[model samples]
Target: MNIVVVSDHAGFTLKEDIKTFLESENHNVIDCGTYSKESCDYPDYANAAALAILDGKAERGIFICGTGIGISIAANRHKGIRAALCSDIYSVRLSRQHNNANVLAMGANIVAIPLAKEMIKEWLKEEFEGGRHERRICKLDID
Candidate 1:
């Protein structure tokens, strides 16, 4: 699975950690930066990740920010990008299973490295149950 990881200053460290974890799991990763902890724009990173997925350069995305709110909002603005800001295992699972979310958003302040890894593991392994959920998923794309 090819995944794109994106983050701003606040989420830079955790985004690197998550990238390492994803790579070690044998998945190809595309790092769309804020390479340092210096302040940067979250929407820029979010746009890069969403475009990567839309362009077929990546199949999924993992985005991080201070509160996960701004980044998720930016990603969700793009049509066909269902970015889910989740802090729990259940939310992570359901994001993929029910929402068919291709983008998983996490908060750097809300979730630690360990918890983020656990959530990502659950998210990556869960298959989307696309029956009734497929109808709802289709309605998400207004463009």
Candidate 2:
């Protein structure tokens, strides 16, 4: 999968680690970054990654920040992006399965690297079960 990843200063280290892991797993990764630990706005990176996904340049996106909440909010401002803040494997899977989310958001401070990796793996493995859920997702797009 081609994935776009973006992070603020708070998530820089974790994002770098995830990017390496994603590449090792043979997924194409586009790192939109804060680059260094120097201060930067989370919304800037979030919007960029969201646009990449919305424009069909990426299959999905993973956004990271201190709490994940701010970046998720910013990414979701784009009409076509359903950015879900997931803290566990279940939420990650369900975000794709039920919400058909194209963007995943994680908090660098809330989860360890290994746990985040596991969550990402599960999320990537799950496909959206678009039977009954399709109607709801359609409503989401309209609203």
Candidate 3:
């Protein structure tokens, strides 16, 4: 699968680790900036990831920031983007299974590396259970 990932300075190191991990899993990844640990706006990276998914350049997106809240909020501003901020395995699984989330957001500071890896693995593999959830997701598009 093709995945797009983006992060602000607070998430820069974690983002690099995630990119390497994804590549090792044989997924094609597009890494959007902040390339360095220098301070940068989270919205810029969030928009890049969201637009990539909207344009079909990637099947899914991963966003990271200090708290994950800001980045997810930015991504969710896009009509078609359902960006879920998940910190646990169950939340990650449910985000995809129940929410049909195309974007997964994680807090670089809130989650440990091992747990984040597991969360990402679950987020990537779980299939969306579109039943009643489909109607709710559809409602999200009714703007």
- Write one digit per residue (lDDT tens) for candidate 3, span 34-116: 89999999998899889999999999999999999999999999999999999999899899999999999999999888888
* lDDT per residue as tens, model 1, 1-143: 99999999999999999999999999999999979999999999999999999999999999999999999999999998999999999999999999999999999999999999999999999999999999999898885
Candidate 2 residue lDDT tens string, 60-138: 9999999899999999888999999999988998999999999999999998999999999998999999999999988
lDDT score of residue 87 within candidate 1: 99
Question: By TM-score, is 2 or 3 better?
Answer: 3
Top-down lDDT ranking: 1, 3, 2
lDDT of 1 at 82: 94
TM-score against native, each model:
0.98, 0.97, 0.98
The Cα error of candidate 2 at residue 122, in Å, is: 0.3
**Candidate 2 lDDT for residue 62:** 91
Score candidate 2 by TM-score against the native: 0.97
Higher-ranked by lDDT: 1 or 3: 1
Total backbone collisions for each predicted model: 0, 0, 0
Question: Whole-model lDDT for model 2 versus the true structure?
Answer: 0.93
- lDDT assessment of candidate 1: 0.96
